[model samples]
Target: AQTVTQSQPEMSVQEAETVTLSCTYDTSENNYYLFWYKQPPSRQMILVIRQEAYKQQNATENRFSVNFQKAAKSFSLKISDSQLGDTAMYFCAFMKTFMESSGDKLTFGTGTRLAVRP
Candidate 1:
């Protein structure tokens, strides 16, 4: 069984500041993938960052980055110079690399509501 957990239910940061969202997961699978998704007011889930279990290096994109700890089963997202547009609901997701069937899907956490204050 696999489960994702986001400890922070809500977080606020001033614009241009940096904020780190905490996430942890429990999984028995050796090969898997972790992802951070952002869902804005439009209610569309967008992929922010992704980390492969086998990769030692953390994943980063622009101002968005992730601190992936494979051994500790933790994957946290760090947003630098946060902008107002970054305000959204962040979700942590997990997916097994080996899919037994087409029905395989990702397991998501409760989510963290991030408000980028002006």
Candidate 2:
């Protein structure tokens, strides 16, 4: 079974600062996908960023970037120029590519609560 571990239960950052959240996973499959999701107070799960196992290059989206280490099975998220709006519960998810006929379901971590202080 693939499992994601987020050592940090809670974190806080000042507005306009940068914060990096750590995530590690264990998966036997050679090809899989990793993702970082942010859930705000509204309780909507939003995709922060994603990385394909086959791709050595990390993925970045605006202020969010990932440090993907395939060999170590680690995927970390870096939030730059953070704001009060960035405060939320961040979850790291793992997905294995099943047959096209199969359903798509995401396996998520326990999540890290991020509090951005003004």
Candidate 3:
């Protein structure tokens, strides 16, 4: 079974500052996918970024980036130039590769609530 662990339960960052949230996982599969999702007060799960296990380079989107350590089974997210609107509950998810004929479901971590203070 694959499981994600978030050490921080809550984090606060000043507006315009940068923050990194920690996440680590345990998986025996060699091929899989990792994802970071953000859920604002609206309760909608939004994909922040994704990384393929086979990719050595980390993935970045705008001000968001990831530090992916495959051997260590660690994947962390870095948010730069943060804003109040960025405040949300961030979740780390893992998904196994599914066959073309099969369906897949996402497994999520407990989540870390981020507060961007103005």
Model-by-model lDDT, in order? 0.94, 0.93, 0.95
Q: Better model by TM-score, 1 or 3?
A: 3
Query: Which candidate number has the best TM-score?
Result: 3
| lDDT, model 3, position 101 | 94
Order the candidates by TM-score, highest first — what do you get? Answer: 3, 2, 1
Give candidate 3 regions above 4 Å deviation. none
Report residue 6 deviation for candidate 1 (angstroms).
Answer: 0.5
**Which digits, one per residue and each the tens of the lDDT, describe model 3 over residues 1-118?**
8889999999999999999999999988998999999999999999999999998999999999999999999999999999999999999999888679996788899999999999
TM-score, candidate number 3: 0.97
> In candidate 3, which residue pairs get closer than 3 Å at backbone N, Cα or C atoms, i.e. clash?
none
Each candidate: how many clashes?
A: 0, 0, 0
Q: Give the per-residue lDDT digits (tens) of candidate 2, residues 1-118.
A: 8889999999999999999999999989998889999999999999899898999999999999999999988999999999999999999999997568885578899999999999
TM-scores, one per candidate: 0.95, 0.96, 0.97
What does the lDDT read for residue 34 in candidate 3? 94
Give lDDT: candidate 2, residue 96. Answer: 93
Q: Write the per-residue lDDT of candidate 1 for residues 1-118, one digit (tens) a residue.
A: 8999999999999999999999999988988999999999999999999999999999989999999989899999999999999999999999989555654589999999999999
